[model samples]
Target: MATALPAPAALLLWECAARAFGLLYFPPPTSIAARAYHLWFSGPPAHLFLTAEAVEDLLPSLTRLVVGWTLAAALGLATGLALGRLPILAALADPLLHIGRAIPPPALLPLFLATLPIGTPTQLATILAGVIWPILINTADGVRHVHHAYLDTASVFQLGRARRLLYVIVPAAAPKILAGLRLSVSLALIMMVVSELTASTDGLGYRLQNAAGSVDVPAMWAVIVLLGIAGIAANGVFLFVQRRLLRSGQAARPRGHVLAWQQ
Candidate 1:
């Protein structure tokens, strides 16, 4: 209850300021909210109240965001684990990894556009390029820094390589990996919007660009607000899942090896 006050309070303040100043560019929140509802949520109940515009734009954007993020997460985790487990490989790849991550993702949009198809492929590539670094870097760092005691314990238990990784390395590194994932979620959302801003037919970003091009301030604000809501919702869901996973992992710990996990 306390935490929710800030947003509503800010919106109320914004509403008063916009109304008082009669700002053409910054319309009141009421108008923006109305525009958003009519634009996206004015459909019939059978269609889940999604307007055609929403169906055409919102769904595609969500699909791309999910698919791109999933692919990046999978690749990042796998490569990070391999590199973390192999010091020589990590050493060999460190320079290249740094260079790759250093380049801004948006800067590569042109290259992606030239090389890939202009629609979903380009968007996915952009998202993957942008969001993979955090996950990879954090996962590697977490896995590499996992206390040697954990490894020793695994070895003493005669655990197989896969078992050791599943039970020890991954569980130990879960927190850092989850942190990376959380960070990447925001990056993925940003990239999703950015990737749609050009060379695409439909998406929230495309709609935003269209609205901006038409000088539709209310529509633009609506898109911006929707994006903010999406970001907040995504973060909330990620945090909930993270907590649940951590709790389950802790609960699943073997009694005999509890001290090792605690350490």
Candidate 2:
């Protein structure tokens, strides 16, 4: 509640200022709220509180966002683990990885469009390229720093490679991995909007661009507000998962401590 208080206060301030200034371009917060309700939720609550426009516009963007981010996360984790486990391989790829990271993710959109058929594939590629780096880097670094004592224990216990990775390495590196994931989630949202704005017939970004082009300021602002809400929801959910995972990891640590002590 303390964290959430500022948002309402900020909105109240915005509403007051916009109303007082009577700016033609800046729709008062109240007007934006009403517009949002009409555009997305004026329909009967029986329809899961979604309107036609939202079904057409919002859902597709969300689907693309989820798919792209999931793919990036998986790829990043796999690649990071590989690199972290094999220092030689990481050294071999370091230059190439750095070069790729240097290039801005959105700048590759045209290349992706040329290579892949338009629509979802292109958008996914763009978002993945944009957001994968943080997770990849963080995971690699975290896993690389895993205490050598842990690896020695795994070896002494004759643990299989899979068990070492899943039961030992991943949990040890989870905090840093989650930090990277949080960053990538924000990047994914930003890239999603950018990809839509650059090329797409529909989605929140397209709608935002369309509103701006048509001088529909209130509608534009409403879309921005909706995007903010979506981002907040995503981050909140992910943070909850991160906390649960961390707690589980903590619970498992004592067993490892006992084993090490016995060894």
Local distance difference test, per candidate? 0.92, 0.89
So what's the TM-score on candidate 1? 0.94
Leading candidate by TM-score: 1
Per-residue lDDT over 110-177 for candidate 1, one digit per residue giving the tens place of the 0 to 100 score: 99999998888899999999999999999999999887877898899999999999989999899999
Superposed Cα RMSD, model 1: 1.7
Model 2, range 27-98, lDDT digits (tens) per residue? 788899898888778876434767778887888899989999999999999999999999999999899899
Task: Give all TM-scores, in the order shown.
Answer: 0.94, 0.91
Model 1 alpha-carbon drift over 4 Å, by segment: 1-3, 254-263
Residue 165, candidate 1: C-alpha displacement in angstroms: 1.2
